[model samples]
Target: MSKPLEITNLYKRFGGLIAVNDVSFKLQPGEVVGLLGPNGSGKTTVLNMISGALPCDGGSVRIGSTDITKMKPHRVAKNGVARTFQLVRPLPTLSVAENVQLSLAFGKKRHWGREARTLAEEKLAFVGLEGRGDERVGNLTYIDQKRMEMARALASEPELLLLDEWLAGLNPSELRIGIDLVKNLQGQGMTVLLVEHIMEAVRALCSRCVVMSAGEKIAEGPSAEVLREPAVIKAYLGDDHA
Candidate 1:
């Protein structure tokens, strides 16, 4: 059976600002759902709440029937959800393989397991970073660093992955590679939820998408059609959008 993710009537507020309002969505295993919106449109807020970095005021988040809305980040992660930050944060001093080793072990359940060096190496190879594990993470290029983050997330073996603006800094080839990586992960049965500004990438990678504007979900469905939505266009493509 495919694992699924569900978000119900989610709400997040800070002072007078409602960063996310009444947002709800769901995803099945092996699905890639794009969470699309312009800047300050609450996309990251939703991801943060799912990842347990922020508290939701009025809603629930669940992965395969497990309620994770109010759980701590660690607890939520242990329930089989993992996320990558907009700013890639690899340990500069650690070797690339070491970074993956640490996250694969600690990213989910309180690792304390065997170091499993071979497993770490295999994960590095899985993410297209094979043979480079001996290099310090600080020395990798921007795109390579991002791939390392993906590797780290995958190392935990989560059923679901959340990515925030992952393509923002990549070159064209790198973007293609990243999309291919996501596709491969999906083929391996991992679900993905991504928040992105890169429309072309969104069009290529997502099977469906949820569109947000001013902190609310305005549209959700097939990616191509949803991108044509007026709210999605105005918020993301400006008045020039059709």
Candidate 2:
């Protein structure tokens, strides 16, 4: 079942720099929401906190009714939250399938042996990587590596998927494929929170948007309207655009 994500008063600091400040938003079950911001806007920091890769200085993160504010990364994954990092990280020593198996072993639903292998391959195929499960992670192309990372995330069968710029750096054709892949996930009722700079993809995929600038939320609403807001425009294209 898809789960809702609620973040309230989320904050983070690095010494004197406040990376995030009292940010809050809610994602209803199966809704795809865009997190937009320019470089250093703390969008990635927010994802890190939500995935337990970074500790929150102050705030609350919840999946459905369970609090996950302080959970470890693995524990957060076990609670139906799965994410793809901005930088793809695959186990270099392992085969593509094995990398995905790690997620299956530790994800919300635990699988083992042939079951895990079978499920992992199924996910790979779902991401358009059929029959290449035995290949080394290093052997795949950049886009293929991204596909593998996504397959690994999906192996967890997560209720909420966090995608951090997964659509960036794709060629036009590849971008279309990426967009379709996200659409497929949305169609399958997976709630998604994506941080993307590609305005086209953001406009195509998200029903709603929450935009941040300088660690503070500047706009939130329907994707089209939010993208047109003065504050959001200023954050992305500077004062001239606004």
Candidate 3:
């Protein structure tokens, strides 16, 4: 059964610097929640903690009733969490199909050999890569690489998908395609936690938004309402913006 993601009082520290401080939020099943803030606001830190890419110094993360705060990244993936990075990290030496195949092999339910290849193709098609699976990832354009990343993440069939600044650096047309792809994922019942600096995308895709400042959650609620909050406006655009 699918479960809601519950994060409570999570914290992270890098030496003397507190990267994430007592942040807490819940993502109900099938919800697309945007995590928005300025650079260094701990948005990605929160995602890292939930996905087990970084250990939390304090607090807990739960998926339904299971505590996943300290799970290894693979274990976290097995428990139905998957994520993409702000910088696309596809295996550059491998074909696009091969990258997706690797994800399928290591995903929640592992596939092997030919089965993995077939499934990888299906996933590539899902992300609009369709017949381009044979091309090496290094040869692809930036937006196509992003699509490959999404295909690999979806190969895991995760219950909760974390997207970290996936729309960064795209031109207008690419941005529109990216937004539609995210909506398509949501339409297929995937729960998402999106970390994006693009407010338009956040407004278009997220039903709710969480705003952070200096490692703390300062505001959260409906997307439009939260974005207009005095604290949130101040954090993003400065007091002058407010």
* TM agreement with the true structure for every prediction: 0.94, 0.98, 0.98
Task: For candidate 2, write residues 1-242 as lDDT tens digits.
Answer: 78789999999999999999999999999999999999999999999999999999999999999999999999999999999988999999999999999999999889999999999999999999999999999999888898999999999989999999998788998899899999999999999999999989998999999999999988899999998888887888889889
Looking at model 2, residue 119 earns an lDDT score of 98
Quote the positional error of residue 101 for candidate 2 in Å.
0.7
TM-score of 1: 0.94
Who is ahead in TM-score, 1 or 3? 3
Residue-level lDDT for 97 in candidate 2: 99
- Global CA lDDT computed for model 1: 0.86
Query: Could you tell me the C-alpha RMSD of candidate 1 in Å?
Result: 1.6
Clashes of each: 0, 0, 0
TM-score for candidate 2, please give it.
0.98
RMSD per candidate (Å) reads: 1.6, 0.8, 0.9
Sort by lDDT, best first: 2, 3, 1
Worst lDDT 10-window in candidate 3: 1-10
User: Looking at model 2, how many pairs of residues clash?
Assistant: 0
The lDDT per prediction is 0.86, 0.94, 0.93
Least well predicted 10-residue stretch by lDDT in candidate 1: 107-116
Instruction: State how far residue 116 of model 3 sits from its true place (Å).
Output: 0.5
In candidate 1, which residue pairs get closer than 3 Å at backbone N, Cα or C atoms, i.e. clash? none
